[model samples]
Target: MATLPGRRLLQRCAAGARCRLLGTVAEASPPREGDTIYVKRPASAATRDETSVEMPMSFMTGSVVGKRFYRDATVRRADDGNGWTVMLDYRTLKSPAKRPLKLPSRTLAMAIAAEWEYQESDGIRPFTMPLMKLACTALERVPVTRTKVIDNLMKKFHQDLVFCRSPDDNELTIGVHQKQKEKFDPILDWVNTEFGFKPVVYTSFFGGKQDGELTQAVETVLKKTTDFELASIDAMAAAAHSLVIPLAIFRGKLRIEKAIELIRLEEDHQVILSHYLSLYSGSCFSGLTVQCLIPPGR
Candidate 1:
C-alpha cells in the first residue's frame, strides 16, 4: 500500500531545516486577487525570508474561488522520490491540513492536473473537480475519521434501500414488488452465499434487522479496505443509499450503470406510470367526446 510522506518530514523540508539548497523557480505571471501563492524555495533559504511563501493549507479547503491564479498546472515527482505531486506554476500542492499532497500514482496526479487545467479564468469551481476533491478527502480526512466513517456506514446498513422491499399485495406496488424480486433477489442470494447468512428483507418503512454475523462480516470487509478504496466506497454508498450496491461494485459483481439503474428503480417506475396514464387519459377522453357528437341512429 502506498503511503503519504510523513508530516514531520514535509514540515521540516518546508522550514528549510538542515536540507540542501535547490534552484528556485518563479511564477510565470503575477497572481490575481484571492490567489494564494506558494513558491518552492531553495532548502537553504531562511524560513523567515520575504520571498519564500509556504503553500497555504486554506487553498485545499475546497471552497469556491474567484479567478484562476496560475498560468499553468503540472505534475512532478516529489524530491524525496516517495510519490508524485502536483504543481501550480512552481508551488507544490498541499492538503487542507498543510501536509504534502503526495499522490500514489502519476496517472492520478495527471488527472487532477487536468482538472486544474480545465478551470476558467472567471471562476475556480471546486464542485467541477471531483477527482481533486476525492484525493483531498482520502489524504486529509480518511485517516483521522476512519472509525466514524465506518460506524456511519454500518449504522445505515440495516436501513439500506435495497433491503426494504415493497409489499406485493398492494395494487400500486405489485409491479414494483415484482421488479424488485427480479432485480434484487439475486443480489440478496449472492450476499447470503458470500456472507453465509441470508439478509432479512423488510416490508416496513422503518427497516429490518440483519443477523449479527452478517453485520460483522460486512464491517470486517470495510475495515480491511485501503484508505482510497474506503473513501470511494463511502461516496458510492451515499449516492446509491445502499452499502451492498457499492460493495458489489467494489467486488466486481456489478457494473456502474446497473448500480445506477437499481438506485433509480422506483423513480423510473413512477415516470413510466405517468407516461402511460397521460396517453390512456387522452385517448379515453377523445373517444368519449367523439361518441357524444355522433347521432344515435348512425
Candidate 2:
C-alpha cells in the first residue's frame, strides 16, 4: 500500500518516539541553544543516519505587497461563449498563472471584479482574492485537470476522520474517544441516511478498506456535481482530510464552529498533551510550539 507521509509522521508521534523530520516540518519543539536536532538525510545521500543539522524555517511572516497595476476593473458577459469574464480597463484580466480568467456566472464575475475595484493603488494582496482564486481554479484548471483532481480527492475517502476512532484504553484517551464518537458519529449517521451511503469506520489506522459499493455510491453522488463544486469539495476535503466534513458543510449540515472543532481535534489533543507535559516537567512552550503541529503542506 502507498504511504501518506503526513500520516506516517502522526503514526511515529503516536508511538512516542522522538522523531527527526526529513523534507517536512519537525514534530519536536525547536532545539534550544546548545541543543542539537538530527535531520534525516535523503536516501540518495551517503549518510545512513545523518545527524545535527539546523534548517531555517522559511515562511511568509508578512503580507505580500504589490503595486496595483490597474486603474479600473469591470465585468461583462462573454460574447465568446457560456458566461462572464472580468476585464481591467483595456486589458483582459488573467489568473496569477497568466491564464485567461473566465468565470461561469455574471454574478461571480462581478464579485471578483469588485474585489479588484476595491484594491488600493498602493498595494494588492492575494489574500483578498477568494472569489477570483476559486473562479480561476474552476475555469483555468478544472476544465482540463478535473479527472486527476477528482481521483486524488476520492482517495481521501478511505482515511476520512469520520472513519477513524480514537484509542479507548485510558481515561484521557477514552475521553477523546468518546468526544469523537459523540461529536463525529451522528454526523456520519446523518450522511448515511441522507446519501444512502454509509462509510466504513475503523478502530485502527491500518484496519479498514471502504467497500466497493459504498465507494461507488459516493463517487456517483460526486459525479453528479458540477466541476466547480467538485473543485471546492476537493479543496475542503484535502484541507480537513474528510470527504464527509466538506460534503456536510456544503449541504449546510454542520455549522462553522462544529466544522472547525472536527478539523482541529488532533491539534487540540496535541495541545492538551503539551500542556500536561509542560506542567509535569516545568518546561515552557512558546506559541510556535503549538503552531508547529499544523501540517505545512497545506
TM-score of each prediction = 0.76, 0.62
lDDT of 1 by residue, 140-204 (tens): 78999999999999999999878999999998999899999899998999899888889999999
Q: Which candidate has the top score in TM-score?
A: 1
Give stretches of model 2 more than 4 Å off. Answer: 1-66, 74-84, 87-92, 96-100, 105-107, 114-130, 276-298
- What would you estimate as the lDDT of candidate 2? 0.63
**Measured by TM-score, how close is model 1 to the native structure?**
0.76
Q: What is the lDDT for 1 in model 1?
A: 10
Q: Poorest 10 consecutive residues of model 1 by lDDT?
A: 18-27
Error of 1 at 208 (Å): 0.4
Residues 1-298 of candidate 2 have per-residue lDDT tens digits of 1134335434645786433121211134344432222233446755432211221211011143344544445566665777776765545565544455667776677667666655554544546766766766775677788778767767877888888987888766786788788888888898788777786777887647887887877777677778778878887887898888988887789877889899998678767766665554443554433422322232
